[model samples]
Target: MTEQTCGVRDVVDLGQDDGDTAEIHDECGVFGVWAPNRDPARMTYFALRALQHRGQESAGIAVGDGKTVLVRKDLGLVTQVFTEADLAAMPGKVAIGHCRYGTAGAKGWEAAQPHLSTIDDTIIALAHNGTLVNFDSLRRELIEMGIPFRSNTDSEVAAKLIGYFTQRGHRLRSGIAHTMRMIKGGYAMVLARENALYAFRDPHGIRPLVLGKLGENEWVVASETCALDIVGATYVRDVEPGEIIRISDDGMRSERGLPPADRHDCIFEHVYFSRPDSIKDGSSFYLMRHNMGRRLARETPVDADLVISVPDSGTPAAEGYAAELGLPYGTGLIKNRYVARTFIQPTQELRQRGVRLKLNPLPDVVRGKRIVMVDDSIVRGTTSKQIVRMLREAGATEVHVRSASPMVKWPCFYGIDTANQDQLIAANMELKEICSYIEADTLGFLSIEGLLSCVPSGGYCTACFTGDYPVEIPKSFYEEKFLPGYTPHNPDPSASDASISISDIAFDLKESENGD
Candidate 1:
């Protein structure tokens, strides 16, 4: 194992124009490979780079040789964390990798994964994506049972839980199944041992996990297809909800860890988290976003001479909007792609110049133009406000702001790190008030129905937009966080066992340990 350090820096991407707030962040990305003849560690590094958009705070890889497990991780972007020497030193047949943007733990070296733990006599490393809501109580129970912990992350809790169960006489897959039934919330996890790889997902399927074929016997699993493409693998299928897939010299096997619940895939993947080149639900994210823009234009038409996007994230939608209305489409702003992170602390005066550091207006494209600026979503409205002002100052005659998705009014508990309700500008301000706040001549958000129509047909957890959650949240976890008069809708109360007693759980484990 090896570790390195640097000051904790905030990564600015997507709609984080001001750099003060990242409107939203997917929890992390996970990738694992089971290819004996291949350079699995190098494959994992390339895969993590492909999934880098999902996380930027940390990157790590754990490789399992025939005899032991080795891990190298640190707090930084993937490019900064590992080098050719590091990868060349760790030769292994199986490996799991992680890139994290923490939504459930502190931003420290210990919180970065793939988290290492021991299961009886063997070493195992686990990489996880998504937040586990009931982890605090689980952590306490494990601690009471003499289990030690090094970090406050739910990922570590999951690792220790699997270790605890496996130490008690059950097979590793059975232990994983037991852990799956206990933890609640959205998650997709990949675990690596000395000679094998295992991948699993939550019952509700709130997070994504896909399996791919490297050749014949070699198999790989990752958070997105783009990762598979980067590693020269062929898409196989999604690891179904509540399913456990194990790959090794034994080939591949799958079984139900828990009965699959109603699907509640995160809809925000289409909005921002996924790269445009990524494929989801039989369509490229680019096509889905393009359809969203077309739907948004029909629903909220504005008088404008040109249509522009918040660069990169919003480009597809803006192009579709221009095509639908026969309006001219041009690049009004150019982004400084090099501005991924800053090492120096930003002063209050420097903070005011935040948006300018990442994006600049092209006067030639927007001058004398009545511009409609399209963005993926508006959470706090700070970035949108700065971008709008920048366009106006660049000689735009009038500026109208359009959000491609519905207003994000509620906090997300699945995996996305959204602001508190009071901090969410859309939750507090009316449409007109938000328009005034951002200093735009007009502002419009796509309706929930309109937004859903643009994506593939499936159940989605739109909790951030409509306060509808697929899994039940513990009252203790969210009672104080929800705004007054807002009732969270949990469609299926029977789906979650978060309130299950710890004593009953302990007793069950004891019975299993005794071969009852």
Candidate 2:
């Protein structure tokens, strides 16, 4: 790793090349509040910073100072964009913030959200975390109705649709109800306006949104409980799937708009996406991952002297696996903390080599030991194969592979960028075949039942594993399904099928001024 100085910060330059593979992100992160008497923007800034791990592409905050919504957003990390001055400039008692990693479409400032729409006299700011499967149909419908879009984001359509309904004399809650009926995908949004803040989750609850209370006067809504902790708020509970929560100075109220035909929280949250410190749907993410590792050990016993995890997401599970098998656990790999999510590489092959820049095997720890490697999930199998090879080169006699989640067979339509079916190794090959292909001595994945059991609540979307979608699956999907569309001059069909690589998805939105 090479170190370079940027402005007073030392940026570590990990010289690994980039790869053509794109990993799907779990969801986006969003936080919003109506603390009219407090500096809600500062609180939101901190909350978004805490949830930054969920997304790295862009960050922004919109403040409604009981009047106009003040907004700022850019394509960069939260810390890189929201300076103290920027946060202070956004002073308001009510604020909403979003951290986004684009799952599909081109990456640009225009796509960086806090998507604001004006209808009649009202302006609504929307930040969404999940994908909309029916976005094409919805976009066409809105276009036919003369609504012009500024970005290629589905959240904009949802915002415009809500704005249109609210302008036509429907209440905010009623507009949400009407909009929910038309959207067919996973969504967790926080909508804020001049006088109110609204939070809602899809019927399937494929994304996560929760409510919290800070003191007696301030109420908070966020994508995860971790964000609540950041703002010194006590976690209230998860915003139930299909539930609409309305918050204002008059106190909080909730109205159930629709009941889930099936409760399917995204299973990947526990396995790889969410912060270990977070509590989702009453389940401890850290504990759930630990249990998954323990179960993986029991189900797929292997002879190994040490258990090692891929850093960050895979650490807790590796510990659990080690404890279950009475094997020693050690920090066998280290990740360079400063690597940007999207690094510019000279070529696609060079990019594939970039994973090593982020992660490197600790040769001293793994040398001469039979290692059991635990990771969250295996998508295209390229990263896993690369990691395994790195371990072998570091002198491991054997590398036994295990995934904390079940094999993902189907692509996700609800915001997650697991877009191409054929790219998934588990989708096409048997366990034994995959093991050989990846050059692992043995490979084991958490069972779908085991995954469901790990969750605090029984309801969650394991569609990627079970191939059972909670909502009606769309016959066609957006081009930004898993990978960004190629430019006219540079078309790479292979790059277009890569999975969405961000960790989580959640967004905060505010109703347009006209209430429509």
Candidate 3:
């Protein structure tokens, strides 16, 4: 793979943060295409752009020709990282792509995916969408075995694990199955070798992955249906939990990699993670969020002259809330979308400017009006407080804030980069206290049950809202990291079924080797 040096213009990337904090950050996105005649790299590029809302820090694509796997990746948005010539150079049949927000590792060039690893004389690249809770111990074990590592990332750990097992005489699918059984936490992964592409998901279905059909032989897989739609692929079905599907010249093959546990699809995908156009269980996320707004209005009615939203993300819910309450809906704030990212160091004045760099209120719309602001969710309340102050400065008489989702009191262990329990505003403050902190005249958050009612019916991971984790985290890890008052609840006592000891895995591998 060739690395091209490109210069970035001098500006501040709001994403990198100039000391101001965002309410919530996004997780990662992954996509894969197994199209022979078509331009797989270009298709992946467009798909990554479609799924860009899922991540913004970095983007990468790996193309697997019949001879070798070639990758082009860097720390920037998809548009910034790739030129037309870059995609033209990588001609291949099978490909996988990733956009990263970096919840599991450092936000550096090395941490970008599709993470490359070698098995015997062959090469493979893996793109992952979620976090692996047990990766730290697994990395240490591999290190002691003399396996070299390039980055401290869960994705790298996974790539190495597959290579480790494959080098032990197992087939690539077997290696993937073994790795799936061993790794813990929520993940949706796409792996590509010289001629084949593989897609798999965690047992609990805590993350999302979908299968799509392009033509007779071509196939596509992605973290969301929106990516598939962008590439003209028709959605087939979700890549079933704990299942692995491999596509190649031999056609597609599916196998149970791990026994499916209780389905705990991430509810936040409907709340904020997935794109508005993305489909989940026969409904669009935009529709779901709009429903959430209607439910919120019924649960907590507010008397305000106008209803507005934080911006693009919260607009659907804001409209729904306004329609349901018979209140006027207007654009009280304008967002500077181009100001999403920058690298320039913030001076003290710029730090004080904060959210104004990204958002500004329109005095004509909000002046002398009682404004009700709707947002998807609030994490640290930093942005919310700043926005409230901005509205007041724009001549808003009284500001009321509403969250479409329930209070995010517990930190996420899946893919989302959430604050710790102590840093979470809701976890530290009660309703009135939080309202005062944000300087909102009034504040209301949708109830957990109310939120569930708005989405398509299925088991959901409400850990961030309810502290009920579908997969069990080690008590020691939580005890050492989190505050004493916060304890995660696992609904099923039997959920730790996949917590097999490393000795057991070794014994299992040895038995299989002897059988062969």
Give TM-scores for every candidate, taking all chains together and pairing residue i with residue i: 0.94, 0.87, 0.94
lDDT of 2 by residue, 112-227 (tens): 87888775766667878888777777778678778898787888878887887666534768777767866777889988776678889898788989899997767999988999
Provide backbone clash counts, one per model: 0, 36, 3
lDDT of 3 by residue, 1-516 (tens): 122111111111111111112746656999999999999999999999998888888999999999999999998899999999999999999999999999887889999999999987789999999988778888888898798999999999999999987776468998898888778889999999989999999988999999999999899999999999999999999999999999999999999999998899998898988889999879999999998888788777778999999988898899889999999999999999887544566898988888888899999999999999999988888899899888999999888888888888898888888736777887887666677678777778888888998988888999998888887776544554566777788555355645575446657777889997
Worst 10 residues of 3 by lDDT: 9-18
Candidate 1, residues 95-164, lDDT tens digits: the string is 9999999988788999999999998679999999999988888889888878899999999999998887
Selected candidate, larger lDDT, 1 vs 2: 1
Can you tell me which runs of candidate 3 are displaced by over 4 Å?
A: 1-21, 491-504
lDDT for model 3 comes to: 0.86
Q: Which of the two, 2 or 3, has more lDDT?
A: 3
Candidate 1 scores a C-alpha RMSD against the true structure in Å of 7.9
The predicted structure with the larger TM-score, 1 or 2, is 1
Model 1 steric clash pairs = none
